[model samples]
Target chain A: MIRKSPMKQENRQTISGADFEEYFQPQNLEKALEIKAEYSDQIEVAAGTTDLLVANYEQLHQIKNWLDLDKIDELRKIEILENELHIGAMVTHLQLMKSDLIKEKLAVLAAAAEDVGSPQIRSRGTIGGNICTSSPAGDLLAPLLSYEASFKLQKAGAERIVRAEDFFTGPKRNLMEADELLTEIIIPLTENEREGAWVKVGRRKALVISTLTLSVVLEFEADKIIEAGIALGSVAPTPIRLWEVGELMLGSSLTELDYKQLGQEVKARINPIDDLRGTREYREDVAADVMVRALNEIERKRG
Target chain B: MQITFTVNGEERELEVTPYTRLLDLLREDLGLTGVKEGCGKGECGACTVIMNGELTASCLVPAPQADQAEILTVEGLGTRDDLHPIQESFVEAGAVQCGYCIPGMILAGKRLLDENPQPTEKEVRYGLSGNICRCTGYAKIIDAVMMAADKLAVEGSDSND
Candidate 1:
């Protein structure tokens, strides 16, 4: 006979089968936020439960009561506003890949979503979970940073917007308060003609954490780069915008030599640490190489 | 929590803890052992199931989250008397060796075929990337999926005729 451990018995008692009213699944966003504000410290907000479930299974997350947001219809809308694309936080990566608006306006984001996990993961993993997890190697972060996305966070009755660059403070840390729910992501759409490229170097072709990822967006004015945005991932504490590299590329027509210099500068700017996926030296070298490749691809596409 | 969901076409209501995973609920409470758990993590697709018309790793789904969801497991595909086209193809192509990963592989193939009736070899490999078949080396599994796709196409046309 198998004996149930004391810890398991205590856990079962805490979440007894007879008391099945612990899960709070609010159908509307307002109600969900109200619950969040009320039980800010005790309740965990779950979207697709892709990352949350995994963390809970690994015993990393101990929160038992969850405020499931999957039933909230308002948090799953993807709207193309007048000059920006407003994506609901609950929009899945698969949904992003399938959206025509995302494909046309935010091609780099769609590409990054396509390279996320396998089909199963993409089907359930949401942009909200990705942003809230705030992992250094989050595949969607680099592209969103490159696009200069901002988040719409809401609590019970108050709301605030935060730039994506400032949202992530460190690895697995963000600016979201305990009661604030990230309701939407707003990405500004450029009026001028522009090209974007995203490249991720992982250990395998699929379902692997990115060793180094790069996203580059360049706005052109008659063959010269008038504006540029560059974001790098997994080589820092959080996905970081390479402002220096973007500044260097501004007002200049990109050439092979310019890309080479920019790649080296990116390598010098980042402070990568040794990890299981790769050593600091490997990431430093390959981050530059991948940035150069992304620039080259953007250049080729521009031509 | 008391959750009600559709399993294989039948509605099921069960009382489960907040921490129970969909995989455990299916294998233990529902007694559907067809869904295997190779890795508790989502790294392996052995726990793959069709949830709400999308392929999902059941292990990564909390039981409460699947409250109103429609789930399809390997047992829902067909039986020994009437096998699914994919299952028949697996047998014909000798894709079943250890048989540990075949259920998830067949579900992955079903998802691929349901979306794209005729997928290329590369698409097949990409579709089944999450599932790891250490026994067949994936050559026979690919063959099985291709054969099933062909058979499904013919059946679809015949039904129209």
Candidate 2:
């Protein structure tokens, strides 16, 4: 329940059409970068507009000038290169769920995408917008983190690739510079066969933010756990990779006891804060319980 | 900004502010009151509409986002004289209680049938998960969509035969 402040409404000026300086719909990447360079601070680059429009409606964002990126065809492509699967930043959740490449290679990501809002929300919500929002409870971030995804950020003259784990600096904040735009996500394909699962515990079946979420990716070699990636969300300031627990499980045949220890370790490591959705204690407990359940599910599948 | 888009199969050009949402544009500018605004946010599907053959929450969509896109609202579904099969099914199933959530529910049903003609009970429930109806307990709503699918399938096969 968001409380509307009467004083805030009174302070807002009635914005009319004349007040908008410009609405730039860039046709190509070059033009979009050029506009970004010129008015980086003044403009807001919109893709999907799922989070942005909601913020604007809630009076949380005061954006004026617009750079609509929906027309840029290159940013919406999902391609499979030699070494990695390249997902354009503008690719919507529905597109991700429908992609055979994603289903075959990144099954965890596909599952997470399917768990997102609803059919209507998924049609318009993009992977880029999800990353940009950087919410601690973002459904895709945990899966992407577990998959070791990297993001390509582009500015007017140069671009850089950053690891998904390093992209977040804090809640609702990332390493994106003022001039840089997140262009693509590259998930490197591994030689090792990986089995993974994504589980999100929310208030309801649909359109509810997660109270706690877990994404587990385990690589096995002949019934021995060769490698593992464990990521947790909504129990910390940012979605975090449980490296210690993953390291502990490596090279060991995971047993029921190992799963229990992993759950206890996860409960110890997470830093949950009390909030409206849940208490700190509840989140802490659920995080461990879900992590154990996910590992058990993965182990069962490996057989 | 002046934008041109096809609404209900008609080309419409309107000068709207950059901040204008599609929900406001539909209800206020175009006078299409059939599209309800339950929650200004995307949580509720009351503002659901089919844009470019995909279901979208109109409230979260900015007005310029609809430029050159074909939009289908409740008004486009059917007329009072000739209700769409799904709409008629809702009437036959007694799916309406308050009637506030019917438009979105009908649109969701249309999208489901368009993509999957023969949906299971679980699929129907998942298809309409975005829509929330405080009344009817959703059993009748599911029945309505299932009934519509059966009727459409029979009619479709009849046309081919």
Candidate 3:
């Protein structure tokens, strides 16, 4: 005997049978923005869809409108304009890894991109999606924050630039409005002698979420540290720039600096929790260790 | 939603639900079983496919986003009668222990070899890092890829001559 349960039927109905209302693939950013303005709250703007499609299917099934940004050529550009590197939000990790400009100016970001999930993930994951997803452990976030990158957020007729430091609210959260789309990332290029390092520790070399990530960029003026940009990921709610550590290192010579003291300050600044990848204490411990190691890399490079 | 894409040199137009993933669309709708779904999340590269000349996890790609895109699957590589060099190398090197991860491994090797015709052993390991094979301990798989690279290089030189 065949039986039909009421609860099963209702659950299937609530899931809507995996049917979505609309799917929009706009060729240009203008049409994309128009669609965004119209269905701001209803649309799910996908950049690469690497993380989006991997997310809960129930949420995706509930989506009223799907906006695919893959067709927007304007959003996939990487250009250098007037001392700033303008990378389109849809630029994939593979593009970043293979880009000559990124390798020349932002080797740290390229290193981070190379360490991301796998070749397949790197081919599909984008910098914009990395920022928008806003995972505290995002591989690229540490490098981005270290470079003082800013995002270009666009609505239909309005656009605003938000600094990387101020963009994140918490894990998997950002300062983006429902109507706004992240269009580009602008990193101001400096002419000074700059050396940077990206050091990440994970369970395995590939296809593993990082346990901790450290990005350090040091600007040197003939041996003395003119400026230091130190950022750590997976140690805080969001990938954070160590303002105290930066303040401590400014105008101090690397040779005369107190490595042990700086390590303590780095440990003190971050607040991590026990997760599957690592324990809170382990993250706090390595947070300092990797910082010192990354600084040492910068020191070695300076020589 | 309807998406038109080229799969393995053949153009296919199909009606897929908006929530459908490219993995499902390929396997269920298109009947390409070479693509496997081990982990729906991007961690496992079992569903890896070359989409528009790039290695991408089909599981993570929404079906609607594949519109007018070019895709390549393991089935497109070679038939049973005539095996691709990579497949031949895999069989010759005894890299097919479980055989579940062979498709993704071969695709990874293909992309790697396509970009770097002559890759070092370290490079081969790095290139195939995305694929996870539970059997054979990966030594044979790496050897298979290296052997395939040599075969592909020889074939290229012969064609040129």
The 10 consecutive residues of candidate 2 chain B with the worst lDDT sum are B11-20
Q: Could you tell me which 10 consecutive residues in candidate 1 chain B have the lowest summed lDDT?
A: B11-20
> How would you encode candidate 1's per-residue C-alpha lDDT over A253-274 as one tens digit per residue?
8762477778899999998889
Q: Report iRMS (Å) of candidate 3.
A: 9.5
* Residue B88's lDDT in candidate 1: 96
Which residue runs does candidate 1 get wrong by more than 4 Å? A1-17, A58-62, A255-257
lDDT per residue for candidate 2 within B8-125, as digits (tens), equals 9888877666677888788877778889999888888989999999889999988788888999999999999999999999999999999998999999999999999999999999
Docking class of 2: acceptable
Ranking by DockQ: 1, 2, 3
Q: How many residue pairs clash in all the candidates, one count each?
A: 0, 0, 0
For each candidate, report what fraction of the true interface contacts it reproduces. 0.50, 0.55, 0.57
lDDT string for model 1 (B62-156, tens) is: 88789889999999999999999999999999999999999999999999999998999999999998888877459999999999999999999
Per-residue lDDT over A1-303 for candidate 3, one digit per residue giving the tens place of the 0 to 100 score: 211112212223334444444778889998999999999778788887878876755366766678889889999899999999999999999999999999989889999999999999999999999999999999999999989999999999999999999999999999999999999999999888888989999999999888999998888787778878899899989999987788888887889888778888999999998999999999988988887887788788877
Model 2 lDDT per residue over A241-287, tens place: 98998898888776734677788899999999998889999988888
Q: What is the lDDT of candidate 3?
A: 0.87
